[model samples]
Target: MATGTVEHVKFRNRDMYWDIAADLHFPPGFDESKTYPAIVVAHPIGSCKEQTSGNVYAPALAEAGNVVIAFDASFQGASGGEPRFLEDPAQRVQDFSRVVDYLVTLPYVDADRIGVLGICGGGGYTLAAAKTEKRFKVVASVTGANFGRLQREMAGQNGGVIQALSTIGQQRTAEARGEQSAVNGFLPETAEAAKQTGDIDIIEAFEYYRTDRGQAEHGCVLFEAAHGTAVLGWDAFYLAEELLDQPLLIVIGDKDKQGAFGAYRDGHEIYERAASADKTLLEIDGASHYDLYDRPNGAGEALKTIVPFFNDKL
Candidate 1:
């Protein structure tokens, strides 16, 4: 059993409603005098912290005897930002750094031992954050995707990117004219509809977000279409080989084949590109991409590797 308390907390440039809404998990015992390592868990893009990081990853890391924080990014979930679902890769990276900054002020935290764990797009953002943020001593990602690149690849699939970009351009034009940005859903409203789209990623994502399996009533798939262009300029591995000298670990599942993910282990290129000789690439057998997110068995196996990696490196 985990021995810690969880609390809903928020802090930012200083406001409650617009702050980074988060959950703080403390280690197994109460000790105000002792300093402890801290970890930050970033949720997938288009996902709220409550689903993945706040509930699953953060608790696991906290179970391993460290403080953990899981937070919603700007313009999503409980957090507040204008033009909701504005997935600015650069801003998301900044969110990670700011979280670290907040942690630095905590008297009980050992700032030097701080670490970060990001899931999916959050994983990419985490990599971007670690690029220049020296405060994160170590970094790890689960089922990490370079969302910017992923967006481009998805948009470009079937030669739709050009059209998508045109639409994005129009939205930008509307915004410049002080018109409300166009809002649209990125996922189907139901699992069946998503499956009918013949897009495997959409099908799986819908299962997680639109159904009872992983759905959060307050969750959203509607985002500003204009933001899609922002992803075109981002890469998860940005400066990774040169600046990511700190230890790194990437965990992913291996069952996908012929689907959008294919059978390739996640973050393979990242591992190859990272300059850190100490980096590790772990792939859980018999698990698909979504499995790594919350499958009880897969999550257990992932922790076997994750808990040890952070304990040793951090």
Candidate 2:
């Protein structure tokens, strides 16, 4: 049987204590024979360790002769935080770095050969973290979204400025009156209500993230009031040109409709621009955006490329 442990651990930042929802997995054959490489897995936005596919990927990699630590982001999952679901890109990057800090302290981990896997929004955070965190010897991002671009579009789309303002204003009003403003969940319980909004991917996202398949009640979207605090002048794609002199791998679904029609072009262009000579990109045909998470070939295709990349790099 595989060995695992869950604990409430705190990492220091300046002087404040940052609590983490941390899980350490030890494969059946795990032994203290020698130091083994370890990888940190980050879940998607609005997702916890149990909500997203991290639960599958983390242990899979750990079983492949690498120790894996899958943890909930600071404000989400079972982690401690106030005004739940608040997402900060800078802080999220720090979370990955902090996880590395935790891993290095273990006698079983090889601190020199560390790697990280970030899925979806977590992928973007992985890239962002790698930009400065040299501890990550290898970085792999799956179906990553550029957070800054997402925020900019949300603030500038058709009537976006007004819509964002109105939404945030309404949420703040409720909060000021000592009310817990309702936030967005994965689904609305019915297909008709799911289609009311133009978020094309929500239909499928709701099917998985809201149903028993991938559902986790803790993974709720924040209200607009929390948007300002979470997004605050943040952008994930600031420096796509920097070279880390390490291996890099990126995976995206060729059929991801959430990024507009045939949006795989953006991911391809990123792979082309990466300065790492050891960099590789895989575009899976006939796969949807959400398919990369829990779909049949999703985790398989991802591990097929990711494990080897980490093996070669770390």
Candidate 3:
């Protein structure tokens, strides 16, 4: 059992026009009168707070003597937004800042000591957010991936950028003409289906999101088809070389196969591109991209480094 207490909370995303759902984790001996360093744990693409962010990292960070908040991005989970299942990178990046806005309002939160940790796709968005959001004093990513790059590369192999854009254009027109927008699943419906494809990332993703391992009612891996264009064009580290100057830590699996969805390459790329004066890259041997989500050899190993890094930096 966990030692910390969790508080269900909601806050407004001013730019996205939605109410964001989140969970706040307080340390075991939390004192209302004392300010504490805080961390914002961002969930992966197609995942909700109840999975890794809330279930794994939040409690662990709280137990390490920090206040941690795990949140569902707008348009997903319990968050409010129209055109449900939209996966806009711009909106996702903004979500972090919105979370910061809420965090600073808490009397027990030390606004100057706030940091952020993003996993998988959320890791990419965290980099983007920290680039411009100066309030985030420190930044870290676990198996971070640029979703836009993922979409573009996948589109390249499937058809082509032009073809993918044309499809999204047509979908948007159809929706404008009163047709229901098409929704697409992130992975195969079942772990068995994913295994049949012979892709380790997909198989692991299906196992995590579809099974009791990390499943949650709101962890639906679906997105609006028309929004593909937005994701395809966006780059999480667009201005990172020029603007991401905060202290940074990047953790990735050394054994990641650099598959279609692998973050191994991205992790190193960001480590090279980020202009942060203080930065460190850690690769966990014998772990894969999804392993960092919850597996002991993955997320657990990462915490050994993460808890100390945040404690020192924040």
Candidate 4:
């Protein structure tokens, strides 16, 4: 596989440890005199920088005259975090912001022109980062999820907010009493089952991430079944207004039913409602959730819109 320069890097804050592994891509005939804009590509949950989605998106952004840095989230992939397998939405957002901090220190990067692109859960993180960090001048969320909505549905009507909290409390109590907390969240494992979600992209996601097309790098995410942290955790909507001052781009596949693109619709609405006058939403017809991962046409469609979005805003 073709690769970029793998930099073993560290970014520190008193409260957290970030073991950042990034592949920096600068196109051929790179120039040092000019400072390039940057796109920090965030991997989906349970994913690493090597996944095809990240692989394609980062390089594509680089090829389009921007610098790209794709890195793993703190707890998963080759990144560092304790109590392994613990995933928190708030921390994930912080991870993205920290990446911005790291990027600003680089001489070749135009700190004022930084942007972020998140796929799947990464998309949500991208929104969260934009909401919280003023440094991200432009932000994009691809086939994303609204974790709050996801939690509400997963908990079910019978298990309301109180019930959900109670259940997680019980699990934590059990863990405190020497019992191990079991992780329960997972994507459909089979192609047929994935298709049954009424999402063609989900089925394709099953084919790519579950198979060799993207599987060699990392395993799928472990569902937080007991606590449903995605819901109980921080809400991106809480910080939505902060992003109003910046440019935002949201890309969704019309056929994506796996919730990535669907979630983008909500995010787009939020951005539209924001006072920021520089936001654009593009919905690609016939594209599914997985299509944006690596296929030339799908990725092509995304870049066609994305390159121009960044070009105008960045």
Among the numbered candidates, top lDDT falls to 3
Tens-digit per-residue lDDT, 156-234, candidate 1: 6776777888889988988899987777787777767887988556677888887777888446766778777877767
Model 2, position 136: C-alpha lDDT score: 88
**lDDT of each residue in 236-267, candidate 4, tens digit only:** 56646655467777777776644533554565
Question: What TM value does model 1 have?
Answer: 0.92
Off by over 4 Å in 4: 1-10, 31-34, 192-202, 224-227, 257-261
For residues 248-268, write the lDDT of model 2, one tens digit per residue.
888988777555322254456
In model 2, how large is the Cα lDDT of residue 248? 85
**TM-score of predicted structure 3:** 0.97
Ranking by TM-score: 3, 1, 4, 2
lDDT of 2: 0.71
Find the number of clashing residue pairs for candidate 3: 0
Q: Could you tell me which residue pairs clash in candidate 1?
A: none
* Candidate 1, residue 19: how far the Cα is off, in Å: 1.6
Kindly report which residue stretches of model 2 are placed more than 4 angstroms away from their true locations once superposed: 1-15, 155-159, 162-189, 195-200, 227-232, 243-245, 257-266
Model 3 residue pairs with clashes: none
The CA root-mean-square deviation of candidate 4, after full C-alpha superposition on the true structure, stands at: 3.0
**Which predicted model would earn the best TM-score?**
3
**Candidate 3 residue-wise lDDT, 1-314, digit = tens:** 24678999988745656799999999988888999999999998988999888988889989999999999999888898878888999889888889999999999999999999999999999999999999999999999999999888878864698899999999999999999889998898766789898877888888888888888988898998987888988999898989999999999998785556869999999999999999999999999988899999999999999999999998
